[model samples]
Target chain A: MIEFLQYHLPVLLIAIPLIAAPLAVLLSNRYIVQSLALAVCWTTFGLAIWMVAIVNQSGPVSYELGGWAPPYGIEYRVDQLNSFVMMFVSGLGAMVLTYSPYSLKAEIPLSQHYLFYPMYLLCMTGLMGMCVTGDLFNVFVFLEISSLSTYALISLGRTRRAPLAAFQYLIMGTIGATFLLIGIGLLYQMTGTLNMADIAEQLEAQRLVNDGQWAGSRTMLVAFAFLTVGLCIKMAVFPLHTWLPNAYAYAPSVVTAFVAATATKVSVYAFIRVVFGIFTPQFAFELLPLDTALWSFSLVGIFLASIAAIFQQDVKRRLAYSSIAQIGYMLLGISMADVDGLSAGIVHMFNHALIKGGLFMVVGCFVLRLGSVQMDDWKGAGRTMPWTSFAWVLGGLGLIGVPVTCGFISKWLLLTSAIHNELYPVAILMLISSLLAVVYVWQIVEVLYFEEPSEKAKHATEVPPLMLLTTYTVVGANIVFGVWTTYSAGLATKAAKALLEGGSL
Target chain B: MFVSIFILTLLVVTAITIARIGDLWAAVMFTGIFSFLGACWMLILDAPDVAFTEAAVGAGVSTFLMLGTLALAGKTEKPTTSSSVVPLFVVAVTGAALIYGTLDMPHFGDPNSPVQTRIEPSFMEKSQSDMHGLPNVVTALLASYRGYDTLGETAVIFTAGIAVILILRRSNDGFKSNDVFNSQSNSRKGSQ
Candidate 1:
């Protein structure tokens, strides 16, 4: 049984959710569908943990679907990088599922509860598929699956503006996906394979034959441009981020928590995979001056987005902007193009998912009790719903990169990496961005503690214990992973080393 | 070759007409015509299967749905006051970039191209031996080798269907099957 599972787990991780998605709809009973989704999520999380164990024991694992070998059939490949990513993503999905039922009651219409589960499962399947699949075209297919479901999920928000937000996202997301398909098509035209590793090998061979000049080909350059721009749009990097704030603000709280945590992070993962795994680091950085471009964008995005976050009155939108700034930090790490820097990027990605996801869950708790996500409405919430507000404070500290928090570890690594690479300006700019985070986080703290209670806050009480438990579990994980660096940071360093050394040990 | 050029010109003209028309009803009809022209071009390219599918699905079923939507919604589009120059410029640049990228591509029907040389010949051979000499290699590959992609496509369609129902359904009425059933039966009785 163990051996069978070890061999088949990668495909099963994706296939289980893909199949369960439709089944959740067919079952159609709210309670039944809810439990079904919960079971599937926890099961996926368990499988991810088991897969991590397997990958740790074995270097990497690849599965060929339908008994066909790779470069021919679709391949699901999990290395240290993706396995670590899959672990957090699935774990977060399971956590959100646990928190969804009660949160949905307050925000989502009861009639749409069953429909929501299937969409959630579909989104999970798509994300997991993207992480696991080695076939570039397969990634596109999964991207659409997740994106379509995400649009529907976002439109299920209580406000009428939800559909408009969803429509806007649909337009942007479709364009992004189209660009990605064009890129993959171009690459396949050049290399004649959809398998990522095979494409890399072919490109590397071509580079060698051309005396390291093949990367300068117009076709390759165009393909790289399209792919990077497509991923940046999906990642909501700076100027392309017009769609994110409203979508995150209007979606049901559970949807916001899940999508904000995983969607952009997965896009970042795809960006890393393409740049370092498919195109060599030599091509991405040295050949194209991409590092300079990335760091410039990252610096501007960090400052501008942080300023935007400070001006937002809606708490969810504030966090949404903060999420963009956090993404800039990850990009800054990637721009460094060294082991410590890449590892910092990877660590920050994981840490931000936990922190932002936990913070959003705290927002859900407040929404359930206070019936509003506006800053004024949350006035004196700390006095009323003490536990939930405390959770936010804990999550807020992580966002501000306070010492002994997960956010600080990533920030510390990023700072040291910048200085180590002798990019003092970049290091100083990152510190200033953290101070900006302090301003926005302080805004929330002031309303929760200093201001007098609003009418809603006076009536607000602690959320249901189950919801509180799940929120605490995530926020607590931020601290746990912060202190116990052996798992999160350790795994990220190993993965970065492997990625920098041509994706193998 | 002359026929291909004529069809291609018609396709471009139809596309521009669809964009320019103010009456949504006419625009939608132009869209159907545009898809039909695209199908004809595909047929000329010897992809009869794709042409047939596009004709039936894109031109036929999509037009029917558009007509249904027109019945429920406005027949005319709302005019936008925004400037068109930026959009036009963006489109021009993207088109130019794509053309530039294609400049480095192998000529049409070049056997030395990666698509022609790599993996496809193996697919052809495998289709012959694996499926008792399947006549259509595309079908064999789609069904047997890359069936998971087909499944993913099916799931995408399913997601679209579910999204439509979720967005369009009246939440106040609830999604219970009895409500749907009673409404259908009532309509039948009224007709009778």
Candidate 2:
């Protein structure tokens, strides 16, 4: 039983949530459904942690579905990279599910609460599915599953603007999905194989035998262009991020927190997988010149998103823009394409998810107490909702890369990588972006701490116990991961090494 | 060749109808027609799996979703104000770039192309032996070698579904029995 669990855990991690989601819907009782969803998420999180441990103990685990072999049957390949991301995503998912009941009651109607847990479970399942799947077309199918579900989840916000935001996301998201499909189709048409490992092997053979560049094949180039643009839209990279702010702003707090934490991070992972896994570094750097393009775009994204973040009045909108800027930091690291740089990017992906998840949860708490997240409404919330306010500030500090926070660790690694590359200007730009984060975070801090308390807030109490507990859990994780860099940094380094070494899929 | 031409023509006609339709319902119907034509084209291209997915998702599910949205937002088309030359220029440039780039591509169905010569041979010859019992190479690939990407994609769909439900699910008792216009009249009387 133990051996079987160890071997087949990856599929179970996804199946648990996938099955639990619909089961929750069938149960239809609010409390029961929420508990069931929470249980499943927690179990999945535990399974992910164990899977990570097993991967560390062993190298990479490969499980063939229904006793099929690789390059023929669909394979679930688990390495240090995906296992680490799986842990972060599922861990945050469990925490967010714990926070949802209290948060949902304030924003969503009582009747809708029953639907909320199930949908969340399904979303988590989709994210996990995307992380674990090894096939190209399966990626598209799962992408649609996640995309369609997210469209529904975002539209469930109570605000009238929710529909419009969802519609915008829907349109943009569909285009992105379609572009991705076209890219995959072209690749399939060219290679006549949907298996990534097979494609990699064939490409390697072609590289060795033929002086001609398969990497520079027009079909491959078109696929690269389509995939990059599509993923950029999904990641909310600068100039393509218009749908994000409103979607985040108008979404119910729970939804915002979950999406903020996981959605774009998953997309970034997809980008990395395509750039590094499918197209080897030699091809990506030599044929596509991806590093140059990504570097320039990331630099522009850092500055532009920071400037935009500073101008937002709504707290959620500010965080949304700030997220785009932070994504720049991750992209900058990835653009370097070295082991250390990629490590920084992967580490930041984990750290940023924690920070954003905690921050959004704090915002949700404020919404519960004050009924809004406007800067003015947060006036003197520090004095009333002291724990929640402190969590927000600490989370803000993490976002700003203050010392002894998870954000600082990520920044330190990124800066070290940049300096190692002799890219002093990019390193300086990173510092500048941190300063901008400081400015935006301080704005919220000022409202919560320094500004006079509104008359309405005199009676404001701390959010419910569950909300406070969730906030503290993520905040504590931020601090712990920040102080002890052993696990997160190690996993990131291993994953980066795998990519840098150009491991065959 | 004739089938390809016929399917292409039908697709073009449906697309035009979708673009030109004045009524939202008509537009929705035309969109369905367009997708149906597209699915048929995919079928003619010898991609039954893709055609099935397109028919089920594009023509059926999406059409239903659009109509549901129209019911919520009202079925009237927002009045168009003026011609948009900027958009036209952008489209022209984009289209031209795409066409220019495609000119370098290997001809359709070229057996000697690098891609067809390299990977296709392995998949064609070895897939059955590689996977043992699995007959469909696509399914095998989807579930195995690239399963990680599929996992992520599934998460994306699940997230999108949750997001939609979270955003659009209406609050009970938020809406009154009367319409906004009626409520406004009642409020006016009360104020007077």
Candidate 3:
């Protein structure tokens, strides 16, 4: 069994969830289906952990689908970078699925419960597929799998705006997917391969053949631009973030928590893979002005979106805006284009997933008991539901980059990386942006604790223990990973070094 | 070449008509026509398999689904009050960028192109041996060499089917007259 798992874990990690999705629908018993979905999620999470261990023990693991060699077949490649990402994605999927049943009771309709489990599992499968697949077109295929299911999951929201939000997301997501396909097609035209490693090797050979003029090819540049923009939209990076706020705010709370944490993070991972793995940092940063452009957009996006978060009245919407700003931090780290900076960015993906996933689950608790996500309705919630409220405080502190939290570790690494690169001004700007996080986080903290209890808050009690336990589990991970930098930051640095070593294979 | 040009022209015309038509029923029909024209162009380009799939899936099935939607919903589209300048500019810029990118591409059916030179030769020989002498290489490739992608494609269709069911299925499929649902839907209605 051990020998079997060593070779097949990568494919099994994706296949388990993909197969369970349709199986969930077939079962059609809400209770049994939910249990099955939960089991599948945890099982995939276990497989991801095992895969990570195998990768750490070995170097990188590549599995040929149906025994065909790569560049001619779909390959599932798990390296330090993606295996790390896969672990968090499946980890959060398991956590959220655990928290989902009780919270989903109040938000999603009972009749739709069975359908919701299938979509959730499919979305998880798609996300993991995107992480593991070595083929560029395979990325697009899994992107659609995740995206289509996400739209369906969002439309299952209780509010009337859910369908509208889902429709808007569907439009923007389709455009992004189309742009990505066009970019991949253009690259295939240039390199004649869809496998990322082969494409990278082909590009390197072409550069040599052209005496380093290959990077200047208009087709290559156009493909790079399209892939970056398409990924930016999917990542909800600032100006292109119109679809995200409404989608996160209006979706069922569990969906919000899961999608908010994983979807954009996976897109960011994809962007990194394209830029570093396929395009090479030297080509992206030196041959072009991509680094400068990325940092400028990321800096402006951070300040703008962080300020926007302060003005949002709905708690979920505020968190959504905060998510955009947090993404800017990740982008900023990427722009630095060094081991420290890249690892900081990668570590933040893990940290922010835990922080934001925990915070959203807290919001779901409020939505469950208080029946409103409005800040006014949540006044004095801290006193009535102390545990859940304290969970928010922990998550909020992590968001604010307070000491003894995972958020601080990423910020510290980012700060040092900036200063190391003689980017003092950028460092200061990052600090100022952290202050903006404080302002938005404080606004909620004040409402929850300081203000007089609303009628709803007064009547509301703590959520069920299962939901609260899952919330704390995620929130507590923020602290645990915060203190223990070995797994989060250490693994991220290894992944970053591997990525920068070229081709990420 | 003349027949391909005529089909391409009709494809462009149908696409514009689908975009400009006020009535969605007509728009749907025009979309079907556009897809059919596109498929014809593909066939003229010697890709009958692709043409057949596009015609059956894009023109036939999607148009039927759109008509079903129109029957259930309304047929007319709402006129936009917002300015079209921004969207028009965005579309023009994207189209220009795509054209600029295409300018560097090898001419149609250029044998020296990387796509033709690098992999196509090997695929022909590989299919005969690896695919057990399958007559059609496309089928062999789709079913064997890149079969995982086909599985993913099937999963995409599955996801879409489930999405349609999730969104359009009757709300009261199960849990008839449960007080939990009653109160929840009532609150939802009140919130709306």
Candidate 4:
């Protein structure tokens, strides 16, 4: 059993959700289907944790599908980087699934309840599978899988605008996917292999022979360009973030929490893995002004998205725009292009997921009780639904990088990295963005806790126990990860070490 | 090169026509024509697999979905309610930038290009050792060397199916009225 698991654990982590996804629609009883999906999520979550443990003990773990060898077969790679992402992805999956039933019961139509389970499970399969795969083109395939399911899942929102939002996402997502395909096709043509490790070695070797001219081919440059743009768009970086707010604001609150936490983070991982992993930082940064481009785009995203977030009256929309700004922080770390910076970025990915996931879940609780999430509807409701409101404030602090919350840890790491590099402006900008966060968060706080309780909010009570429990669990985790930085930061350091060393494989 | 250029010219012309035409139905049909022409261009570039996908997905699935949408929403082009200059400017800038970026690329299909000399030939040799010989090598690559990608593709298609069900399933009324759908489609075309 140990030997079998050692070989198949990576594939099993992906396949479990996939196998369960199809089975989700078979049950007529929605309860059974939800239970099955929840079970699948928890199982995958367990597998991800175990997989991370195994990877830690034994360097990188690689599984070749159908006994095929590397450079020739499909490879599932679980290294420090991916294992870290895997734990967050599947862990977030389980947490979101745990919280979903309560939100789903209140929000989604009954006829669509069974439909939701299948799509949710399939989306989980797509995200997990995307992170686990090692092949470059394979990432594109899994991106599509996750993206398609996400579009459908978002369209299942109760509002008429849901389908329109889903359609908008589909258009943008397909364009991104096509760009990815074009980029991968170009890379395959240039390097003659799809396996990431093989491509890296070949490119590295060719650079040595041709004094780097071969690696500097315009085709190579274009390939990198397409891949970067495609992925940045998928990551919702700066100008490419138009599709995000609507999709998040209008989707079912359960979906908003899940996709908000997992989707863009996975896309960011893909960008890091593809651009920084296969392209190798030496070639990417030297041959191109990639860092300058990243810094500019990310800086703009931080200020612009944050300012936008503050203007939104709808609480979910506010959080949605805030997500774009948080993503900018992650990108700022990428722009630093060193081990310390990378570690900061990866830690933020994990911690931000917890923060945003919990915050959105809090929004879910509000929508569940108040029937809408506008700021006016939440007035003085905090006094009535004290527990849920308190959890929201906790999550809001994490978003603001408050002390003793996970958000603070990542922001501090990012700040130090920025100042270490003497990018004083960047450091100041990060501070400004964090302050922007405080303003928006405070605005919501005042409405919820300070203002007169509206008549609509007069009857509001705390959300159901299960929902509140899950939200508080994530909120507590934000603080725990913040205060006890040893675990999350340690994994992030391991991942950063692996990524910046041109990969262990 | 001449044949490919001829096909390219036709494609460009078709695209221009599709854009200029105000009749939505005609534009949709022209889009199918453009897709077919694109598949032909892909064939000229010696990428039959990509051509197949473009034809099936672009011409087949997309056209069908557009028709379904037309059945629900009026197909006639609304009056130009939005400004065109900003969009046009954006396209111009982007197109110019793309053209500039291409200036450094290797000429098309240069035999000694890095593409031919790089990692793929070696990867092919490595794959030759597997039981599956390179009979229709793209298939081998897709099925064996990249089996997980194929699995992902299956998931993508499955997700799309689910999306269709989610968006369309809730409204049972739309499916029952073929006459209304057809009349709506016809009126839209008539207005155009």
Best by DockQ: 3
lDDT of 3 at A270: 99
Using all chains and alpha carbons, the TM-scores for the candidates as numbered come to 0.95, 0.89, 0.97, 0.92
DockQ of 3: 0.49
Those runs of model 1 whose alpha carbons end farther than 4 Å from true positions after fitting are B173-192
Q: Which stretch of 10 consecutive residues in model 2 chain A shows the poorest summed lDDT? A: A210-219
lDDT, candidate 2, B51-83, per-residue tens:
998999998999999999998777878767888
For every model in order, the TM-score on chain A comes to 0.99, 0.98, 0.99, 0.98
Which CAPRI tier for candidate 4? Answer: acceptable
- Candidate 3 vs 4: which has more lDDT: 3
Candidate 4: which stretches are off by over 4 Å?
A212-214, B44-57, B79-81, B92-107, B110-135, B171-192
**Best-fitting candidate, scored by lDDT:** 3
Better of 1 and 4 by lDDT: 1
Q: lDDT tens string, model 1, A91-194?
A: 99999889878788766668878888998999999998889999999999999999999999998776667788999999999999999999999998888899
TM-score of 1: 0.95
lDDT per residue as tens, model 4, A269-294: 98888867788776677667787788
Model 3 misplaced regions, further than 4 Å: B172-192
- Candidate 3 on A1-505: residue-level lDDT in tens? 8888778889999999999988999999999998999899999999999998999989899999998997788888889999999999999999999998878877666888898899999999999999999999999999999999999999887666788999999999999999999999999998888999998898899899887877437888889889998999999998899999999988989999999889999999999999999998888899789988888889899999998999998889999999999999999999899999999999999999999999999998888888788888889988899999999999999999998999999999999999999999999999998999999998999999999999888988999999999999999999999899999999999999999875666
lDDT of each: 0.88, 0.80, 0.90, 0.83
* RMSD vs true structure, all candidates: 4.9, 4.7, 2.3, 5.0
Locate the minimum summed-lDDT window of 10 residues in model 4 chain A. Answer: A212-221
- For every model in order, what is the number of clashing pairs? 0, 69, 0, 2
* Residue A458, model 4, lDDT: 95
